[model samples]
Target: MINMKETINHYLAAWNEKTATAVKAAFQKCCTPDVTYTDRNAPTYTEEGGFVIKGIDLLTALVMGSHAKVPGRAFSLLTMPQYFDGHCHYSWGLHIPGQDEKAGWDYIVYNEQNLITRIVGFLPEQV
Candidate 1:
């Protein structure tokens, strides 16, 4: 089995990548070619699957956009990842200089080859 911590690091590397070429390479190394991804605040949805982005290309684009939207912030693990039955979840925080950190959770599914196949991200809602 692949080391879960290493896998999680690679996953975050894609999100923290500084350039388009590097981000694409980071994602291709850690995720399946046709991986699926969705987050709680995604605005668009499909009738069948809700808000989802399928394929590495689309995922790479999404991260690139994130880099544009929030430059200089980087994600860091706030807690160790927990894994079971091809699934893993972890808490993470976005480190923004002179600003409050944003905490979130990621639940990931891995394929038999140990590549990430799906990622479900969530942000806590205020009551």
Candidate 2:
């Protein structure tokens, strides 16, 4: 079985680095090459109907673009991740310079190899 906590921490640490290279390295270390990542609140400029990234290359591009948009932003885990039946859920937030923190949760599915295969992000509904 996968060590959920370790995996989550590793992934979050990569995001906390706030760099495209760091994110890509993290994915290479803990995610499948064909990982699927979905952000419900992705900017309209991304893929149709928000963002749905498939494969590592596209995932890297998406993360790079995000980092470019908000330089100096940092990510932090707000709660311990929980896992059950190959699925994990965690809450996290982004700290952007001169802006209020933005929080969200991600539901992740892991493959049998203990690598993340899919992730779906959820954010609070906009008013």
Candidate 3:
């Protein structure tokens, strides 16, 4: 069984480490092929069979672009203490350079085998 907390931290730590390989590895370590995602206010949204994202490719693009913005951003879980209706809730408090502190819960939907298939969370506007 995968430790959800560890997995989440692993992904976030990659960004803080500023290693592109770590970032990509983090995604691979936690995400599933059917992974889907969504932002709070996206321009063009599409159904990823779960939370609405422009698309998986778009998610990748956005994440990739964020790396260059003053490296060392980290997402720390603030509080996430429940599991119901097949969705795990995780409240995160993040510290990112050039960006104000933002916090929100990520709704993770795990695949049948326990890999993260989709996640939806709130975030602030990026410059």
Model 2 vs truth, CA RMSD: 2.6
RMSD of 3: 4.6
Which is better, 2 or 3, measured by TM-score? 2
Give candidate 2's whole-model lDDT: 0.76
Q: For candidate 2, lDDT tens digit of each residue in 14-97?
A: 666565677788878778899888876555424435578788767777766666776787778898988888899999888879
Write out the backbone clash pairs for model 1.
none
> Which ranges in model 3 have alpha carbons more than 4 Å from their true place?
14-17, 41-58, 69-72, 98-100, 124-127
Task: Report the C-alpha lDDT of model 1 over 1-127, residue by residue, as the tens digit.
Answer: 3677778899898989888789889888889999999985443322233578888787877777666666687898889999878999999988776778889989999977678999999865520
Give me candidate 3's TM-score against the actual structure: 0.67
- Give me candidate 2's TM-score against the actual structure: 0.83
Q: Return the number of clashes found in candidate 1.
A: 0
User: What TM-score goes with each of the models?
Assistant: 0.86, 0.83, 0.67
TM-score of model 1 (CA atoms) = 0.86
Ranking by TM-score: 1, 2, 3
